[model samples]
Target: MPLILFNKPFQVLCQFTPQEGRESLADYLSIPGIYPAGRLDADSEGLMLLTDDGKLQHKIAHPDHKEAKTYLVQVDGAIDAAALARLQAPLDLGDFVTKPSKAVRIAEPDWLWPRNPPIRERADKPTSWVAITLEEGKNRQVRRMTAAVGFPTLRLVRSSIGPFSLATHPLMPGDFIEVPANAIHK
Candidate 1:
């Protein structure tokens, strides 16, 4: 089975499972047999891989594969180089330390679509943006990392995973495109 790259929209559930009043992938995707290789929280949005192939699913989701996932994070506080450096360093998250990851400050793009139920803004406080990449898919890792550095994440978006990128795809919120099975291996 081939793989599909989906730009998951905010508030949309990552799976076909019914969420009572909440929206799900079944609302946007009609392709049969394909299941999400991994999940993105409904509060976050961006690139997600789906496929009918079990091996490919394991390859993408299994920690042993070490596939890189990158994210663009909007944080509550102004991020500095020192803060970014701490994000890059292994974070002692109590249970276990996070793996080393890349983090950098970046300017916000005007092209970004307005998120539904827009993030809260404070007159006295400002926010900044950063890009971070990790090979491990720990639950809420990016959010945890940012908070650990004293900048809580306000908005988060997965920008890329392995060879697939949201930048190259014409996906708007809730849109998806299928790629050849071979593309998954590349």
Candidate 2:
């Protein structure tokens, strides 16, 4: 089965399921016989994996596989080293304790396109960028985690997944690329 890497744009659904007046994978991907390995929320943007092979899907998306996912996040407030350290440490998220993750401050990218609806900008309020990596996928994990650390996310983008990096592929919004099976693990 062929593996596909998609750079899902903001407000685009990750699955083929039709949403009420919202964009979905059906609008962007035309490849037949392949389905998402995992998902990115409609409000989020970045890397997503798709495959026709159930086993490969399981290997990539299943929690047991512990594949690390990296994200570049813009938060609503200035981020400090202490807050970053808290993210790296386990958190008690009520239902379960999150796994160890990595967080570090980064400079905002100059090439990011303006968000469609636009993120609210406050001249008096400050924002910061951070790159975070997690081995576990959870519902809005990045958003929730950053919020828990007192820096609510303003924008989020997945920069890498396991062995694949968006840096090399360089997908603009709504673009996708096919990866041969042999290229996936290398």
Candidate 3:
């Protein structure tokens, strides 16, 4: 079977196994044997790939592959040039130093769905959207990066992984479609 492009919703666990009071992939996916190639935290949302092929899974999940993962982030405060520069520069995250990433201010995505609980907005503080691309995955990296720079991430969505993108294969939350593994590498 080919890989699956899943639009993972916020608060959904990456694994298929049941968790106490947490929604898992098994709740949405009935297909057997397929598993997520990479993880997206329950607090985050967007495109994720599931496959049964071990080689393809490794290619997608391995840090050595340096697959570009893109995120649409909504932050608690307006991001200034300095913050953008910090985001684009190598970040020291205590345990590891992150590679330089692409960070740019972006207008709110019109195509995005309204997050179920919605991000909390402060009446006095302004919020901004940023498009950030990371070459490597880290535990809560984007959230930590933004907070480290003084602007905490309020909402995060993974819009792409490697060559696969939500734009190329549009899926609403909880929807998925099958695609050839070769298409992901192309």
Query: lDDT per residue, candidate 1, 130-177, as tens digits?
Result: 989999877888998899889999999998999998877757888888
Task: List, residue by residue over 3-99, the lDDT tens digit for candidate 3.
Answer: 9999999999999989999999999999888989989999999999999998989988998886899999999888999999999999898998889
* Candidate maximizing TM-score: 3
Q: After superposition on all CA atoms, what RMSD does each candidate show versus the true structure?
A: 1.1, 1.2, 0.8
Q: Which residue pairs of candidate 3 clash?
A: none
lDDT of 3: 0.92
Please give each candidate's TM-score: 0.96, 0.96, 0.97
Decoy 2 TM-score against native: 0.96
Give the runs in model 3 whose Cα sits over 4 Å from its true position: none
Q: Which residue runs does candidate 1 get wrong by more than 4 Å?
A: none
Angstrom error at residue 155, model 3: 0.2
User: Looking at model 1, which ten-residue stretch has the lowest summed lDDT?
Assistant: 108-117
lDDT of all the models against the reference?
0.89, 0.88, 0.92
The number of clashing residue pairs in model 3 is: 0
lDDT of 1 at 162: 93
* lDDT of residue 120 for candidate 3: 78
Local error of candidate 2 at residue 79 (angstroms):
0.5
Q: Which candidate, 1 or 3, has the higher lDDT?
A: 3
